[model samples]
Target: MNKKSMSKGIIKDILIVAIGVLAIWIGLQVAFGTQNPFYVVASGSMIPVLQVYDVLIVQGHEPFEDIKVGDVIVFNRPSGQDRVIVHRVASIINDDPKIIRTQGDANPASIPGTDFPITKEEYIGKVAYVIPQIGYVTQILKPPMNYIIIVIVVGIMIVKQISKKKNDKGLNINDLFTKNNSEQTENHFSELDTLEKDKEYSTHVESKPLDEDNSKNNSDKEQK
Candidate 1:
């Protein structure tokens, strides 16, 4: 193909690959429910260990009382608020032989003071994992910074996938532009052979020396 056509083909291939990869990534994120799995460290309730904007992974709890003292649990207060509170369990109260209470790590007041000692009935899931500086993304999506970050991350992943494909294909761009070395060398030798045959034919004509045969030339001129 011509140079211009070949260049267009390469550009089209790149665009197709990029779009396909992006689509597959988005599909996976949606299918696996990864979009809903996020955490926001609202207050300094669990400070000294868990800082603000630190992402925590939460799952549905099996039972409130089943969780241990050291485990960080998410729960709500008696006000029926849907807020997630992360705190280490200080103690478990069996009031009327049917309850458990939890407290915080850095509380100035005792477990029963600020909020009533939390029963197992109010408990949510335990903290699974924490990623620092990720809650800020959850906080501000309209600021354009979140969009910029998402774009950058997606771009990096696309680039890595492209590199992987190139490696797998083993496409040597230089060799593609310049034909195979052995084939080129063979064609050069073929052209040289044709040139040598033309030279040999000219030499044979010169050796005959038609004008040197005088009688033959006189007879040839008379016939002409």
Candidate 2:
């Protein structure tokens, strides 16, 4: 392969992998109808049902009224707090505020006052699916660390691709070995052919001399 061909092949492989990753992320976001649908569970509040580092897929399409008791939901924390929580709906009071109580499956009682019976305005969404263990990847690669890791991985991939292209374009060790072996085999065959031709030519030269001597001796004997 030439330099241009090798580079194009490497680029094609990288693009394929990149597109696949983007497709999965986009498909998940579009299907859930939420821009940020995946959440990492830091605490084991949901216990055996949902372990720590489990990723939650929240879908915003379901109406607040449709949320029934025992259904787990993700909602914004009450009052000045700017955090979200995922818990099971324990009760639903159809009032002006439309109270929706929620509690963790592991907790003995419903989540403390003001947070549980969250209003429709506080509701973020309902838990549509649970992806186990992948949240740990998100948790490990957070913020600056995540960016650094991405840069390092991209750098490594670039270096690998460049090296592969070079190997394909230039005579690498494997190519050198194969080329040398082919030349050596051709040389060996040529040497054998040269030796065989030399032997045949020498035999023809020696037989012609012997035949001439025999013909001369026969002519002399016939004359006597």
Candidate 3:
């Protein structure tokens, strides 16, 4: 109802949403085996079909032999390289042990000079989805900007906690008033007892005079 209580509630709500999102992100990583959802095209191997910086969703596939011609696929650029290349399957030149020949859409011929053989294990996955200009944004969000955003969020949470502490101190004023009021009540009761004792002593002092006056009157009547 009060400002302090409202502020605390808002902070709790913000924390809940932030934590929920983080948990979802972690769960997706475990489910998919990747933290990032999209991959950026680094080369022109799939030009005309897919350009540089074009973001595409990569999903697990069965085998390269199962892929059909005209289907866009991504695989390692070259053996022993960590980079990936995206291209279309020109044709299934050989399928005995599952080998395929791939070529870029812009290129004049297929790869490997004479049908570059790609095995079943070489193919990464087919393109699930694509966004034209969003790949550049993903690249930017990858490095320093991600860390910067995390740091800023942590700082805001720390400041909120400090503010909550200050608000708690201000709200404790009511507790102090309650303690003082209880002490005052005890003091007033003690003073009331003292006043009762004083009244009793005054009554005792007047009682002796009345008794003496009564005795004098009785003696005078007896003398007459």
Per-candidate local distance difference test: 0.51, 0.61, 0.53
Task: Please say which candidate is ahead in lDDT: 1 or 3.
Answer: 3
Candidate 3 per-residue lDDT, tens place, 1-224, comes to 99999999999998886776566455434433444434677655444436576666554433455687756676764455455666677778776876778766544345452225666656676664454444465456876545334334433433453477543322222232256567864564345423322222233333333367755865675689
TM-score of each: 0.44, 0.54, 0.48
Worst 10 residues of 3 by lDDT: 168-177
Show how many residue pairs clash in every candidate, following the order shown.
0, 0, 0
Residues 66-111 of candidate 1: C-alpha lDDT, one tens digit per residue = 7654556666664455455676665556645435455444443223
Clashing pairs in model 1, backbone N/Cα/C closer than 3 A: none
Better of 1 and 2 by lDDT: 2
* True-structure RMSD, every candidate: 39.1, 38.5, 42.7
Task: At residue 43, give the lDDT of candidate 3.
Answer: 55
- Ranked by TM-score, the better of candidates 1 and 3 is 3
Q: How accurate locally is residue 145 in candidate 1, as Cα lDDT from 0 to 100?
A: 50
Candidate no. 1 TM-score: 0.44
Measured with C-alpha atoms, the lDDT of residue 142 in candidate 1 is 62
